[model samples]
Structure formats: structure tokens, C-alpha cells
Target chain A: MNALLEISGLTKRFGGLTALSDVSFGASEGAITGLIGPNGAGKTTCFNLITGTLPATSGTIRFRGQDIGGLSPHKVVEHGLARTFQAATTFPAATVRENILRGALLRHPLGLGAMVFGGAAARDAERKARQTVDEVMEALDLTEHAHREAGTLAYGHQKRLGVAIGLATRPGLLLLDEPAAGLNPDEVDRFATMLKEIRTRFGLSVLIVEHHMRLIMRICDHIVVLDHGEKIAEGAPEAVRDDPKVIEAYLGADHAK
Target chain B: MSMSATSSAPAFQPMTVVWIAGIVLAALIPWFTGSVFHFHIAIMVCISAMATGGLAVIAWVGQLSLAHAAFAGIGAYTSVLLVTRLDVPVLLGLPAGALVAGAVAFIIGAPLLRLRGVYFVLITFALNELFRLIMLDIPEFSGGSSGIAGIPKISLFGVTLSNYQSVYPFALFCLALVMGLLVLIRRGQLGRRFAAVEENLALAESSGIPTAKTQTIAFTIGSAIAGFSGAFLAHYVGFISPETFGFQLSVSYVIMLVTGGRLALWGPLVGALFLTPLPEFLRGAVEYQHVIYGVVLIAVLRFLPRGLAGLPRQLSRKGGRG
Candidate 1:
């Protein structure tokens, strides 16, 4: 499969400390790619760099054959990329449907005129936004909480809502930051199945930062491991699982048993 | 999911009736009162409310602008210059002022909007002071300390508005137009986008929303409305002065919005209506009026955080259980 998003020689530095150093990876089109590591392994930092929330000290990020390095976060998303936060952050005062609708409305390019006027073009845009919200909420199993304030949602549902919000943006590549971090075992299993189903159904490329090893291993077609801001190992999930570098960096020496 | 609630249209309700009645009463104030001072107060409320409404828009986008009255001053000067120096008609002058103010706001907002929270507020306050000083310092164009006098009365489509009563309807029309636009904005998609940006900038940006542009749009619109109100006030008073739109006036406008409730659509209107005629009612204790105003503002902010518009809802909720 061709790569939808390409990152090469990526590095980020904060003063004397380098958060990421020469990390390289690509999320292939229509596949699930996982970035796995222990705490402070630069998983979240990598996500931030790819999403344009943090400036890269040096390197290139290409999305759909266009250089997107140094672009603003919103501009990055406008280029067919969307992301969820490590924590389930949302528009706290807005309803669940409204939160998704805000993302969906970004598809309308005419700005305020298209949003306010009831012209044929504006009406069509509004209809699409409503439809996208409905579909995303239903797909995320959040339709039952559509009208509830986003801040009032149960914990797991907030994570789902975060993913649903990213989905509503209709991105070619979806970046999920620790999506299964706080999910229960059963919920993690369901989330893994859902992620796979979403990849196949939406034909989307997904780059996920996760600590949940079971979910990552069960669903990811390809895996890249990071340790101390460096890529320790990478390959198909099974190959990476047995790699001595990844075992030392992540699974520990006892992982062989 | 309750899809039914999403699909249902808003019903014709008591609030609609109340809104219409309020507008009608505002329009008839001059005719029923038959007093010029009453007309003057009514006109002042209309102007103040328009300014307050503009400030509320800025607040909606998560920025508190003290430069609101500066925009009004810009409008006043633009309109006055067009009429006095260029001899343009008042009808065109009014809109020209709004256009210029909006343009200036858009230019300033592009850079200043990068600063968030208290830093934004401090910069805006400095800008307001700068606007006043510029007006005071420039005598030839801005009329200086003595101010511009003997300004011509406004003529709208052939009829000249010569007195307070004559200008009452026009002011009422301006207020209604400004307030109506604000109401439309609140009900439309713009409101949702503004709320999202206000709630979380990072989340909104990640969702593909251009947050800076949204803030700039709010600032421009709010400034434009304030400018339009200023233009109307200048013509009605038949004078223009630096003191007419000063830092104190900006503070009052902010107070009006906050007292009425910053978030609600009717808050500024309720604030302007309540506060504009208050000094006159407190004629017996004119010395303590400012102190009283401060106390009342503090009390409302502390106790009724939602403002007067929210009072009905709060009351209903309290009475519901009983």
C-alpha cells in the first residue's frame, strides 16, 4: 500500500533536551499503523509533531505528496488530517452533536456567508454537516448521548466522542493519541474491533499512539517502537514483537518467557 | 439518539410575542411620552445598547475588548468628516463610518488577536487611550478640546430629523437592525463555532477550525456595530468631541454588557435599558449615583452570574419543584 502520510528524519528539541530524534515512519493508505513504547518514549511527542502542534527542529512531513512541515495545526487538518488528544478533551459546554458538527462545518469553504445565509449552497452545506454529525455519533455508539453536554459524559464515552470528532472532519488520515489508554479490558477489545472496522469501511490511514499492547498488537498491520525518543524497531507486528531491540526497550528481558 | 429533537422546527412561542411587543413599545416611546427629554433618553439607550451588543460579540469569541469605544470614535469621526468636509449625505455617511471602523478593527485584530486573556485586555485598553489622545491632539480635523459644533442635522431620504423626537424613530431602527443581526448570529452556525473556539482553542484548531480568523471576524463585526451607533449619536447630538467616546464610556459599555449577562442575547439590551436611565432616577442622590452603580454591578455579578435575561429561567427552575 502507498503511504498517505510520510515523516522522515523528524526531530524536536526543547532547549537542551531533544523530545524526538531522527524518528521516521509512514502511515500507509487504508491500514492501521501503531506507535508503541513505554512512558516518556516520545509517542505523544511524535503525534504532536505530525499534527503540526509542535514545530519540528528538522525534517520533512509529507501528506498526500505535499510538504506540510511548519504548517499550523488547523492548516494541517485542513489538508485532510485530523487528530484526537491524549486526554479526551472536547468543547466542554457544547452538546455531543454540536462538538462533532463544529468539525464537520470546516468542510464548508465559503466561511460566514455560507454558514449564515439560507442560499442553496449554504443549505446544502448545513445538511451535510448535520448528516456527518449524525453518522459519526451513531458509528461511535454516542448517539444516545448526542444531546448531553460533552463535559458531562461518562469517561469512556468522552474518548469515543474525541475519536468521533476526528472522524467528523472526514480526514484521509486520522491520528489518535492514546485512544485506548483508560478503557477497560472489554472496552479495549471493542475499541480494537471498531478501529479495524473503521479502517476498512472508511478506507482511512490511521496512526495511533497507544500503551495498550493487546489492542495495538491485535489490530495494527504494521508497528513501530520508540524508546527514549528514538525508533528502536519496526516491521509487521509479529516481526517487531520478536525483535531484540523492542524486547529490551519495551517488553523487558522477561518478555521471552 | 433523539433525532426528533434535532429535526423539529422552533415553535411560535411567548418569547416571540414578547420580543415583538418590546420593539413596538420602543418605537412608540416618542409618540406616547410627548416629552423631548424622554425621547433623548430613549435615543441614548438605543445607542448604548448597540455598543453593548457589539462588546458582547467580542466577549463571545473569548476576548474582552476595551477598544470598543475607540471604534465608535472612529465611526463618529468618519461620518462627521464625510458630511462636513466631503458634503456626503447623512445616509451614506452612517454606513461609511461603520465600514471604516470595521476595516480598522480587522487590521488591528489580525495582530492583536494573537495575544490571549489578560494581555489582550491590557493592549486593548492602551489602544483605547491612544485613540482618545489622537482625537484630542488633532485639532484641525477632530475639533480638539472645543470640539466640533453647529454640525448639520441628519437627513434620511429627503426628511430632515431636526430634534430628538424626529431622530427617535431612526435611532430605534438602528438599534433594532443591530440587535436583529446579533440575534441572527447567535442562532446560526457562527454561534456554535464561536462557542467551540471559546471552550477550547486547541480542540477547535485540531478540528480544522481557524480560530484566529474566527476571533478577528468577531472583533470586526463588534467594532463595526459600535461605529454605526457612534455615527448616529454624533448626528443626533449635532456635535463631536474626544470626550464623547472615551475610556469611561468604554467602561460603561462593558459594565452594561456584564450586568445584563455577557453570554445571553438579551443581556446587553437589558443592561443598557436598566443602566441608561438610572442616573436620572437617582437625581436625589446624584453624588452617590456612581457608588450606587458600582454596588449594583458588583451585586449582580456576584449573585446573578447569568444576568437579567437568565433571571426568568432561574426563577422558573426554582418554582418548578414547588
Candidate 2:
């Protein structure tokens, strides 16, 4: 399958320290790719680079065969590549519905004149946006809590809201940084099911960075392992999991047992 | 849970009904007052309300700007120049001032909006100083420190608005227009984006909101409104001066906005109404007038962090619990 997102020779350096060194990876279209690594492995940094929140030191990031290496975050989103941070970042002061509407508005922007005049075009855009918001809320099971402030949501629901925000972008490629990070075991299982359901429904590619091995292993079609900013293994989940380097990277050399 | 979501109040309410009654009373003020002094104070309040309205709009987008009065100055100078030098009518020239101010704001804001928080505030403060210096240095056009005098009275369709009676209605109309524009903006999608950007920039950007553009839009609109107010000030007083629009004026506008409530729709209106005539009311305590003003402001801010607009909510909550 053709890759929806392709990161090649991606490197990020912080003065003297190199955070991501010549990392290369690809997530195929409509596939759930898991990027798993220990702490200080540059997983979040890589996500930031691809999402255009952080500048890359070197290399190219191709989304749908177009080089989008240096676009601004919003422009990157405009190109149909969206991401959620490791921490669930929602507009705390806004309600869940409003937060989702913000994302929906990206698809159909209301210009300043339209905003002031409120004619048929603006009304149509708003109606479409509200519909999109409703659909997204229902898909993420956030309908009941739609009117509540996003900051007041439970930890698990906040994570779901983060995913819902990304979904509202209607992205061709969704980058989720630890969507299952603070989720409980049952919630993690449910999240994996949700990811699969979303994939089947939307037919969009997902690149997830998660420390939850059970969730990642269960849901990911392919797995990539990174250690100290370098790619260590990449293949089918079983192949990468059984790789000696992956075992050594996680357990350390002495604990190869 | 530090975030305080705005109350989900329905579109129409008892408060709006009260606002309409207040407007009616304001319109009838000229009939009751024979003295020009009373009309002058009322006009001052209207202009201050419009200027503070602009400040409130910028604050809505999560920025505090000290250059608002400078924008007013731009409007005053531009409109005055167009009317005196180029023979443009007051109606065309007034809006022209706002447009010029908005244009300058858009240009400056594009680059400056990138600076967040205190740095943004500092840059805008510098901008206010820059505008003041430009006005003082360009005496050839701005009339220097003494300022331009004998600004012609507004003549609309052969009805010369020369007296307090004539000017009061126009001033009231302008204030109404500013208030209406602000209310419309607050109730729109654009306003949602502004709040979202203020609440969380990273999240707002990831949600594909062009945060920079939103900031710029807010700043530009605020500047235009201030310019609109300033243009009215020029015509009402029949004079224009560098001293008229300065950092102190901007600070006063800020006080109005802060005292009114940062997030509430009517915050600035309450602030302008209360504070504009405060000095006149404090004439008996002239020696300690500013001191009294200081104390009152501090007390209000310390007790009512949401400004005077939040008073009703606070009172209701207190009553409910008590």
C-alpha cells in the first residue's frame, strides 16, 4: 500500500544535543501504525515535527506525496494532516461542542464579512458546521457531555475529546501522541476498539505513539521501535516485538533475558 | 478548572429589556438638561464608551493593547485632515478615520500579534508613544502640541448639529452603532475562535484556527472603533490635539474595560458610564479625588475580579448559598 505519511531522514537537534537522528518511517494509507519507544526516544518530538508545530533540523515529511516540511501548524492542518498532543489539549473555557465546532469551522471558514453580515452563505456554513459537530460528538460518545466545559471532563473523556477534535478536522492522516496515556485498562481496551471503528468508518490513516503496549500491540497493523532518537526496528507487530534489538532497547543490554 | 465558561444565557433576557429602557432614558437626557455642561458630559461618556468598547474587543482576543488611544488619534487626525485640507464631508471623513486606523492596525498586528502576553503589551505601549511623537513632530499636519482648533460643526443634509441638543442624538447613535457591532461580533463564530485562542493557542491552532489572523482581526476592529470614537471627539469638542489622545487616555480606557469585566458583553459600557463622569462627581473631594479613584478601583478589582459586570452573578450566587 502507498504511504499516506512519509518521514525521511528526519532529524532534530537542540544546540549540542540531537533529539531525533536520521529517523525514517512510513504509515500506509488507512493503517494504524504504532510508534513505541522508551522515555527520551523523541516520539513526541517526531510528532511535533510532522505536525509543523516544531521545526525539523533536517529531512522531509511528505503527506500524500507532497513535501510539507516547513508549513505552519494551521497550514499543515489545512493540508489535511492533524495531530493531538500527548497531553489532552482542549479549549478548557469552551464547551465540548464549541471545541469540536472550532475544528469543524476549519473545513468551512467564515470570513470577516460573512461573520458580520450573516447572509445565506454564512448561515449555510454555520448549519453545516453544527451538523458536523453533532456527528463528531455522537461518534466519540460525547453527546451527553457536549454542553459541559471540556476542562471539567474526566481524564478518559478528555482523551476522547482530543481524538474527537482531531476527527473534526476530517484529516487524511491523524497523528495521535499517546491517546491512551492516562486511560485505565478497561478504557484502553475501549479506546483500541474505538480506533478500529474510526478507521473502518473514516478510512483514514492513524499514526499513534503509545507506551501502552497491550493497546498498541492489539490495534497496530505495523510497529516501529525507537531508542534514544534512532529507529531500532520496523515491521509487522509480531516481527518488531520479537526483534532482539527491540527487546534489548526496552529491557537494556543486561536484561536481554 | 480555572477556566470560567461564559454563562449559557439565552439570546434575549430581562437584562436586554433594562438596556432598552436605559437607552430610552439616555435619548431623553437632552430634553431634561438645559445646560451645555450636562450634554458635554453625556457626549464624553458616549465617546469613552465607544473607545473602551474597542479595548474590550481586543481583550476578547486575549491581548491587552495600549495603542488603542493612538488609533483614536489616527482617526482624529485623518478625519480632521480630510475635512479641513481635502474638503471631505464629516460623514465620509469620520469612517475614513476608522478605516485608516484599521489599516494601520492590520499592518502592525500581522507581525506584532506573534508576541504574546506582556511583550505584546510592551510593544503596543511603545506604539502609543510612537504615534504621540509623530503627532507632535508633524505640526504641519497634526497642528503640533497646540493642536487643530475650529473643527467645523457636523452639517448633515443642511441640518447643522452645532448645539448640545443636536450633537447628543448623533453621539447616542454612534454609541448605539458601536454597541450593536460588538454584540453581533460576540455572538458569532469569529468570537468563539478568539476565546479559543485565548484559552489555548496550541489547541486552537491544531484545530486549524488561524490564531494569528484572529488576533489581527480583533486588533484591527478595536483600532477602527477607537478611531471612530476619536473622530467623534474631534467634531464634538471643535478641536484636535496630540494631548487629546495619549497613553493616559489609553490607560483610562483600560481602566474602564477592566472595571467593567473583561469577558462580559456590557462590561465596557458599565465602565464608561460609571467612570466617565466620576471626576465631576468627585469635585467636592478635589484634593484627594485621584486617591479616592485609586482606592475605589483597587477595591472593586480586588473584590470583584470579574469586574462590575460579574456583580450580578456574584450577588446571585451569594444569595443562593446564604
Clashes of each: 0, 0
* Residue-wise C-alpha lDDT for candidate 1, range B158-202, written one tens digit per residue: 899988877888888888899888877776777767888889989
Error of 2 at B54 (Å): 1.1
Q: Which CAPRI category fits model 1?
A: medium
Off by over 4 Å in 1: A250-257, B1-30, B284-290, B320-322
What tens-digit string does per-residue lDDT give for candidate 1 at A1-257?
48898889999999999889999888898888999988888989898888889999999999999999999999999999999998889898888888888889888755677555446776677677888888887778888897799999988889999998899999999999999988899989888878877777667889988888878888898999999999989899999988988878765735655
Every model's DockQ: 0.61, 0.50
Task: Report, for every candidate in turn, its global Cα lDDT versus the true structure.
Answer: 0.86, 0.87
Query: Per-residue CA lDDT of candidate 2, range B232-321, in tens?
Result: 899878998998888878888888888888878888888888787788666677566456557768987899998887787899899999
Error of 2 at B35 (Å): 4.4
TM-score of chain B of 2: 0.93
DockQ measured for candidate 2: 0.50
Indicate which candidate wins on TM-score.
Answer: 2
